[model samples]
Target: MTLEFDLFWSFRSPYSYLATPRLAALQEEYDVKINVRPVYPIAVRIKGFFKQVNPLWPPYLLKDTVRIAEMEGLPYAWPSPDPIVMDIKSGEVPEEQPYISRLTRLGVAAAEKGKGMPFLYEVSRIIFGGVKGWNEGTHLQEAAARAGLDLAELDALIEKDPDHYEKTIAENEAAQKAGGHWGVPLMVFEGEPFFGQDRISHLIWRMEQKGLKKRS
Candidate 1:
């Protein structure tokens, strides 16, 4: 039987961006499926998230992500016009976010069309791969095309029932918490959660014991 896992991810997360190419590669090399479940970043989900955390966390996170990208030879940069509209200096999240909501909803639409993994990989790469104004112009449209989706069609689909997508995101978030973590790139296999990009090897080891096979 083919192995399967649910990846709770976020477009606004640098870690999610870091983990995706590896996940996509695993899908190619093994008889497994990754159910890409995109959710809003913690900055949005928990309004006071950054405020409550240690002040050192953000600086450490920046250094850690940068080193990881360098260590892995992955091109990385903080997204321009971050998906979550927050004061970087103040650690304050705003009430109105113009980017992440639509991006997350469109992730749902892509999954509904059976193209979720590709959609996540392509889009996140553009966003986190140093593309300035990644949300502008044809960047997203081109990414969608690469993922075997059309941006306009996905947008239209969501416009028909935006609430449904939002509901799905809510359900995914609830399920994510149930699966063990509330963070992006949380990979769950048979109810076990591997909650970081650094845990991919651990996740693969577990999958191996479960009889993962090479794709022929």
Candidate 2:
């Protein structure tokens, strides 16, 4: 039997970034295919999600995630500028979520061309894997190239392909309807949704229980 699952991911979430290496390895070790589904992070999807986060939550997650990264021996760093919805002026919390919308659209566009997973991994590395100022042109272009994608082509596709982008978003929503309750780095196995990087091992264990057949 093929052990496959959909991985819903957010570029802005550190957890999502932290989740990739393990998720990728699972695909290799278990010979399963992980469908990389990119979605806007909570900050973009929910208007006040960032502002509503408990003050302690950010620092705690940051520290804990770093420890986890250390344990995994993967390169990790907290992006200096941070990937959050910002209200630069007034210092008041408000929705400035267009950034993630663009990212989600791009993600969907790449996925449409069967390049979604690779594109996301490269992009996430720049965004969360400690590359400074990922928004700059050079970094973005390099990430695109590394993923075997043409920057110009992806841009054009996103600009002229509303139907494709909308279809990707619709698919994500449909997956949620089937019971995925959280952001990217989530995998659904046998209709059961598993969220977070910590759950990957558990997912593998479950797949074993279900008699995941090794590739022939």
Candidate 3:
């Protein structure tokens, strides 16, 4: 019996970017399929999640992740311009309704085409792959191409049909019903839920315990 894991992820998370390449390689190592499900980040999904994060979260997370990158032997650089959706103005960051909305919609669109992982990989490269920077006038088009994707076509699809995109997000929420979690980067395997990039190893261990057969 083949096993499949649903990996719910968000593009804005640094950890998500770090986990992408490794997750992509797992297909070659295990007899299982990873269904990448891109979702809105907590800041977008929850009204005030970011504000509630620990005061030291930003610096601490940055320091800790750099250590992880060194241990994993991966290039680590703070994303240029950052992938966050909020904007600071008048000494107060605005709600960032539009940006977050667009990201969530686009994520759903990619998932609908069964190209979630591909899209995530391409997009994350622009944000975290030590590229110049990812922004409105950035080289996103070129980056997408490098990742074997087409930016123009993806934009058209999302622009032309938004309802379908909304539905995909809804479907993901429903699928997580059994797991009792609504967080991104949530990996659900055999009804067990492991959330966050840090949980990937645990997820693989669980898969192994469930009789994950190694390839011959």
Candidate 4:
């Protein structure tokens, strides 16, 4: 039987970007499937989350993510235009988030089309891999094409019933919390949660214990 896991991820998360490439590799190399459950970032999902965080947390996070990306040998940088609309200093997330809302919804649309992993990996690379103005021009369009999907088609899917996509995003957030972590890169296999990009090894270990095998 093929093992499967639900990956609760966010487009705005650097860790999610860091985790994606290896996750993509895993599915190709092993007989497993990844259900990419895209969710809004904590900045939007949890009110006062950033403000409540320790003042040192932000800088530490920046330092940690950069090092992790380097360790993983994946190109890394913050998104050119951050997906979330928020004030960094005050840690205030605005209600009107134009970028993340669409991205997260489109993630659901792609997943519905069975192109979740590739779509996530490709789009995220464009966003977090130092592409300037990643959202402008045809960066996303090109990324979608590389993933065997079309950006316009996915956008049209969302437009058909945007509420459907929004509902899925919200449901993913709820499932993330129920899966025992409100964090991105949360991987849950058979109800066990491994949270963080660093925890991907642990997840693989568990999968191997359960007889995971390389694909033919």
Candidate 5:
């Protein structure tokens, strides 16, 4: 028998990017299925979320992400055109978001194609792995290819009915909240929510308790 879990993730989240390689490894090594559920970053999900946060949070987050990347020996850099476009000075998110909406839609399309995890791992590397101009030229197309997907096809699906993809992301956000956390890189197994990239080992412990087996 295979255990299944939901992975609530976001393109703009450093933690989500950090979690990808390990998550992909887990899927390959264990008899488990991870349902990749991509959601918009909190900057877009909750208006003024950044503004309401303590001033210390952003700096601490930056410091922490860099250290975490070093600790894990993973290359790390913030996205070039941040998936969420916001005025960091004012903590104001723009109404016309040109990046996150498209990325989230593509993620949903990939999930529909049963390649969500690979897509997430490949695409996020471009965005967060020190690549400059990640949104330009064929960066995304190449990433999709690396994941064994077609970016053009995924884009066409979103172009056909963008609202559908948006709706799917909305549902993912609501589900994440219902799962007990609004953070990305969240893993929920049998209704137990484990938030943050650091919680992965704990998630596996729970899986072991549930008789998780290796793939034959």
Candidate 6:
């Protein structure tokens, strides 16, 4: 029998980027299915989220993500033209966000096609793995291809029915909250929410308890 879980993720999250490879590995090594649920980052979901948080959080996050990447041996860098357009110093997010909306919509589209995890892993790596102008030209196109998807097709699907994609993302966000957390890289199994990249091992332990089997 195959076990399945929902992966609540975000493009703007460095931890989500870090978590992708391991999540991919889990599916490769075990008979488990991961349903990718893409949601807008907290900065977008909760207005003034950054402004209300501790001032020390951002720098610590940067230091931690860098160290984590080095420890994991995954290529890492802060995204250029960040998915969410916000002033880092003031924590002011613009109402007109050009990047995150499109990216989240595309992620929903990928999920619909059952290729969400691969698409996100490939695309996030491009954005967070030091690619300059990651959104320009063939960058996304090539990434989609690597994930066994056609970027143009995804774009056309979104173009044809953008509201549906947005609604799907909204539902994902609501489900994430209903599952008990608002953070990215959350894995929900059997209605239990495991929040954080560090909690993956615990998730697997629980899976093992439930008789998770290796792929033969």
Number of the top lDDT candidate: 6
Superposed model 3: Cα runs more than 4 Å off: 87-100, 136-138, 174-178
List the candidate 6 regions with Cα displacement exceeding 4 Å: none
Show model 5 residue runs off by greater than 4 Å: none
RMSD of 1: 0.9
- What is the clash tally of candidate 1? 0
Give one digit per residue, the lDDT tens place, for model 3 in 111-169: 66666666677777666667654656747676556555666777788889877776787
Clashes of 2: 2
Q: lDDT by residue for model 1 over 116-206, one digit each (tens)?
A: 9999999998998999999999999999999999999999999999889989999999999999998878999999999999899999999
Question: In model 5, what are the clashing residue pairs, if there are any?
Answer: none
Clash count, one per candidate: 0, 2, 1, 0, 0, 0
Give the distance in Å from residue 180's predicted Cα in candidate 4 to where it truly belongs.
0.9
Q: Please, what is the TM-score per model?
A: 0.97, 0.86, 0.83, 0.97, 0.98, 0.98
lDDT of 5 by residue, 71-151 (tens): 989989988978888898889998998888889899999999999999999999999999999999999999999999999
User: What's the true lDDT of residue 71 in model 1?
Assistant: 86
* TM-score of model 1 (CA atoms): 0.97
Cα error of candidate 2 at position 215, Å: 4.2
Q: Candidate 5 lDDT (Cα, whole model)?
A: 0.93
Across 1-216, the per-residue lDDT of candidate 2 in tens digits comes to 676777788777778888887776666667677777777666656665655667787779879989988887767887745566576333234555455667777888777777777787788788777777777758878888888888778878888976778677777866855765866567788789888888988888898888876665
Local distance difference test, candidate 3: 0.71
Better of 2 and 5 by lDDT: 5
Rank all candidate structures by their TM-score, best first, as comma-separated numbers: 6, 5, 4, 1, 2, 3
**lDDT per residue as tens, model 4, 1-216:** 899999999999999999899999999999999999999998888899988998888899899999998888989988889998888879889899999998999899889999999999999999999999999999999999999998999898888898889888889888899999888889999999999988988998999999998999
| Cα deviation of 178, candidate 2, in Å | 3.5
TM for candidate 3 is 0.83
Tens digit of lDDT per residue, candidate 6, span 72-163? Answer: 99999999879989997898999898899989999999999999999989999999999989999899999999999999999999999998
* Alpha-carbon RMSD, each predicted model: 0.9, 2.6, 2.8, 0.9, 0.8, 0.7
